[model samples]
Target: MAGGLLGTDVVTQIGIIVRDIEKTSQAFADFFGVEKPKWFLTDTIDKTQATYRGEPCYGRAKLAFFKLGNLDIELIEPDEHPSTWREFLDQHGEGVHHIAFVIQGMQEKITLLAGRDMPLVQKGEYTGGRYAYIDTVPQLKVAIELLEND
Candidate 1:
């Protein structure tokens, strides 16, 4: 608790994993009458990987970004890869993956979380942004992303 923080305590950006990124993104747009969000295929993603339980795995995914009422909504379509998202989708279709939070003092947060022995599910840089997924739920669990310039 010293270096880490409660997810609820952080202002969050919610991302929903869906069977179809286009469909879900449109749904949000239609409901709010907002413009359709831009889409991003896995090929376009700056980085892509999977996590099985909490280790490196292989898979494909489609992602998109949109803005609604100051909230950035992301649609993720997990491929048949062995990723945490894939597991979630397999068990529960498409749904909320994580409540992402952008933080200042990011490197500090990373060190703090690591110092506490939290296992990282995935870590990498993409599209000029650096991010890490920490499975704070037990040893291997859901990820809380610290996306920079997201």
Candidate 2:
């Protein structure tokens, strides 16, 4: 972890929480002159095994992605459930939620970040991967998401 926690500082995705994914996604697509990527809802709690603050979380969000260069711009519209996305939107309004990096050794990375004072906030599973959100705003001014593809 010399260069960075996961051995790389390269960010693969920037996640933004929005109150209106349909409008925001359309705006982004129009601004970039790219076709609007189809928005999809995340898997349910049972399927995703999502947790928030150490508790089972039923929250989910509508997601859309814009691939730009090496980074993916993600738009998230969170449901009313208690999720990091929903909490961020409630407290800070629509804005960047997290910067994600694809990495291996998810558990080790989480432990290392927690030792450095950035603890885990929320985590969940996607179709092909798992993700953990680290509470790094105090030090980095933004959250860090670790995505582990299996």
What lDDT would candidate 1 get against the real structure?
0.66
lDDT of candidate 2 over 38-122, digit per residue (tens): 9999999889999999999999999999999999999999999999999999999999999999999899989999999999999
Q: Where in model 1 is the C-alpha error above 4 Å?
A: 1-12, 43-57, 104-108, 114-117, 137-142
Model 2: weakest 10-residue lDDT segment is 1-10
Q: Which digits, one per residue and each the tens of the lDDT, describe model 1 over residues 1-150? A: 543463335535676779887778788888888888777655323343434445555655687777656577778888876666676699878777776776665567767777778656655556656666666656535557777654
Clashes of each: 1, 0
- Candidate 2 residue pairs in clash (backbone atoms < 3 Å): none
TM-score for each of the candidates: 0.71, 0.97
lDDT of 2 at 91: 98
RMSD of each: 4.1, 0.9
Off by over 4 Å in 2: none
Least accurate stretch of 10 residues (summed lDDT) in model 1? 43-52
